[model samples]
Target: MTNPTALQLIARSNRLGADSRNTNYAGGNTSAKGSETDPVTGEPVELLWVKGSGGDLGTLTESGLAVLRLDRVRALPEVYPGVEREDEMVAAFDYCLHGKGGAAPSIDTAMHALVDAAHVDHLHPDSGIAFATAADGEQLTKDAFGGRVVWVPWRRPGFQLGLDIAAVKRDNPGAIGAILGGHGITAWGDTSEEAEANSLWIIETAAAHLAEHGHPEPFGSVIDGYEALPEDARRAKAAALAPVLRGLASTDHPVVGHFTDSDVVLDFVARAEHPRLAELGTSCPDHFLRTKVKPLVLDLPANASAEDSIARLRELHEAYRADYTAYYERGAAAARARGEEPPAMRGADPAIVLIPGVGMFSYGADKQTARVAGEFYVNAINVMRGAEAVSSYAPIDEAEKFRIEYWALEEAKLQRRPARKPLATRVALVTGAASGIGLATAKRLAAEGACVVIADLDLERAAAAAAEIGSSDVAVGVQANVTDEAAVQAAVDAALLAFGGLDLVVNNAGLSLSKSLLETTVADWDLQHNVMAKGSFLVSKAAAKVMIDQGLGGDIVYISSKNSVFAGPNNIAYSATKADQAHQVRLLAAELGEHGIKVNGINPDGVVRGSGIFAGGWGAKRAAVYGVPEEKLGEYYAQRTLLKREVLPENVANAVFVLCASDLDHTTGLHIPVDAGVAAAFLR
Candidate 1:
């Protein structure tokens, strides 16, 4: 009969995956076994279904489970006493799967299969790892669980680990779970309920033991738990530190940086004892694979100036990288001593960075990955706090760490992720990105893997829009009134600081006025000119300076309206300013061409849906202009176009994206239209 426990296992596994307090994205694995008849032969067979490699447990489905024939998997000669070839061991694993659809079984499957339980869970709970990595962890677990759990020293994941765990299980037949020193924990039972409960029991017992001994919070505030400081003295100091650190921590290619000063991070980094203790290494083996061991910690001085801070971050970055090279040598030597040829290691760049006076930072190729690194490090800090409170904190020895750091399997997990999108390493800034074409463009660029800065006058709305983009690392919302030089400069700084440099600048901020010339006062004309014409110039000017400094040919796109080219009756002020803006693009293209910069203009017509202008009564005003009801404005405009189609914000955004396409290296000083075949507005 097929397993009746699959539902319960799925439920419990998802619960564990969903809670960051338990594990972060794809950090743990789960499995369940059952007996069933083979589909092809109708013969009774035992099956093992475990979480697939690279599959997210939080949203795991039956399709994500790798179905394997249990008898075949357990009998593989790769696990036999005489077999030691990791390649052969890997090949053996691939040979046992029952189907070809799901992802490859997780590297932990062999260990899970050997547990001799219907249900098994392997979790990287921070609380459990605290006791596991404690200086006296071996005995601490023993004392807390009173032999209810077994202790297994760290070993690289493979057939050998399965054998070691099996041996431990054999020795302690009464124990429900075991701790893998320097790694995570494994628990098993007849059902997922029993297995999860026992796992929670082990975690709680270890966590409680530490608390009972002395529940001490790590040092965060300047003055105990009462009134104290949060990181550096001023908010501006903390704000200024992000970009400088981002520039330093980034690698040769591209890695986005994320900063967090949440209370947890501050407490962990602000501790007087952290500098020495933090260097000990990762909370678990999975961490060693994801974030590497240790982090690049920056020491912020009292009342540091901007120049001093920048210089300090740069100096510290150099030292951090140089120290990594030396550490890599020691690790490589240790690996060679094990009689195994060490793989050529990459530069020892710490994935996590802790700043004593601010908070913490994590780097990854993309935003989601950076957040994962941040979450894992935060978990580590909390666990380390608990472990140190109980006794001295300790992690696995250097020899074992060397094995994990160089593990072919652990490295494969990173390399196996999907290929990056075309705009993978680029950073883009979209002004007026709170809604309409700007918002659409921001989403498009972010989806293409570019770090996006959403600049708008309304920061609260812009931030909400950015959050909807769903990757905080790539999407940042900054408040900017483009007419104000300082606000414009600050927005530019936010982009450059967060992403190391800026590449694309979209000058899309604008306002529309439809008053007749006779009724239009000097005030209305100035308001339209100041925002549409002057704002574009100001934002563009600031952006070019940064691009010139980087010496990287970048793109600057101006989103001028269709009125720029076609004279609409009541749009004199808007059209006149737009014409000036469109001419500005050609002028910029001429001037910036020498610096390898490309400048272009996009004129969007009839984009009503999701357009901020239309939402602000522009639709009703335009409908009145056309002598039609307000609700039919979209239809009215669509019918007026040759293509008989509605021009949506996405249509405008697509035109902007085309203008920004990488292949158009020589195609600057152009105006692309998106108005469903508005022949008059078309670029000739």
Candidate 2:
């Protein structure tokens, strides 16, 4: 908070930002103009603070607000004042910063400056967008709020639109706010509190009126909550179908699928008008730019095989892509007919996937994008239902939508962005991620920009690890006991839910019984074999099914040990289980090869620190067997190795990374030893 004026503005902005029903993801902006003394120079100057690009309103903070010289921005060279001003406005945004080290101002900065009010709040509320996009939107705008809100027709967001909005405001200074057709509503006040209350009044009163006038109850479903199904049932379905959808939707591009059957979406889908409404396009221009024209509908029967579902989804994907192409071309032709030069449009890719009888899926380059797209579609569905209740859902023309989608400002954003890491969009599941080699590998994968799911039996620890690793965009933790078929399947589903799909599975969860053959008890043998050997098979089997369905090659890596190749003294159960796991890797590689999946193994020894085995007192006993104290055990192994270096968890993780990397892109059914130099463990 700065001056009282700025504090009030920031408070109201943060209040609106906290609610998705108000300002979702990056879809809204708030601005307040006030006098502030320069940090370097004690002279006061008029300053405008607006929500910056790429910042979410719900989490809006002081830093997220871009500070700019108000007069400097309003005076920005509007070379094409009436024709276009986005380029110039953007340039002004870059150069007019009143403070150092802040994000770029929101694209609506020009419009914010033009408005005459001391405080302005803009939001894409469901109720507001529903009214704005209806067929009779202009008239409805006048009737719904009874002319208290001025109406402005759709204009591309920039200087000219700002001028048009200002003209409307200047002409009607008595109105509280104005609704932008096919966009959203903007309200202003002298105080931040008044601005917020005024904006709320417009939205809430509009919503109440719509409800009273029969706005189809939005979703019109029996369920009263957000959930689509019973908690267990929903989770089970997600687990069963996530990988299948992942493989199908990701055929050409790397897309992660987000599943939802919220009451809103489910009710909309259940409606008789659902199919028509689904293809009618997004309700607002901002969402339209992200969700494309429509979603792909798929028929998923309850008893379908994974293969059947995947094959059917693939067909739908191809058809969706083809239809999108036609839609774009038609829009382009229409633009030319209107004597307007069409901008270069990107290729058609279905952003939303509707699976009847199951739920909905949204796809994007990563998890967050997919989730945000899904949220927008849900809001859109509700808005459409509300509009359909009163009148037809009349969104902006295809020309206007094209303008928003391929606008030069957005294109510049694409160009200015940095290149993503090699595995930036890839998704992976790492078992035993709570500690040791699995933990190290999970972090490494996250660092490489792959969305990772840390699956471990230690549910709390797994989640803790995920938080330590990073954002939901990159990591999540799920409890998965690899030995249980149900648990393994659940783990895969969790991975798919968290990351949209799985491209790699690191089967590294392991256990050991350092006992001689005669000394190994039945419980020890069962536990060791079940965890190491059977767990590996269960996880690999589940992973292979997903990879096979994906039709895109994937990787399944087993964390075996050098003991698999060379059994040492007093190690029976551990060595045998590892050997079994190694064989299973080759078998999976052989069978899943046709599906383009690669199966590999990493054999690493002397991982003393950070491993569960070491924590469980295996290191001390092993050191006793080596005729040395526990403290010297690490050094002893290091000296015994050809390289005379310790075999660490990171070393094992590096080998895992190599197997998953493009270097071994063509190789499969191979084992790479991570020990410094083990001639016998080496693969010739």
Measured by TM-score, the strongest candidate is 2
Where is model 1 poorest over a 10-residue stretch in terms of lDDT? 219-228
Collision pairs in model 1:
243-497
The sequence of per-residue lDDT tens digits that candidate 1 reaches over residues 484-594 is: 999998898777556646779999888777777897889989998899799999999988886675556689999987888887777778889999899999999999988
lDDT of each: 0.77, 0.79
Q: Residue-wise lDDT of candidate 2 within 1-684, one digit each (tens)?
A: 466666666677778877777766778788888988777889998988888876777777777878888777777645544464355667667778876826687678777888888888888998888888888877777777776788888876777767777787789877888888888888888877778888898888778867888554543443223224555765666666676666666655778767777766665665556667777788587787678778887555434454676578778878888887777788778767866665676656677877554578888877788888999898888688768777788888776777677666777776767687667677889999999999999988888778889999999999999999998777889999987999998888877767667888898998766777799999999999988888988888887777776667899999999989975888988998899989988898899888889999998976987888877888888888889999888888888889988888889888888888877899999998888887766665
Where model 2 places Cα greater than 4 Å from the true spot, the runs are 1-8, 38-42, 84-88, 99-101, 215-240, 299-312, 333-345
Best by lDDT: 2
The estimated TM-scores of all candidates read: 0.87, 0.92
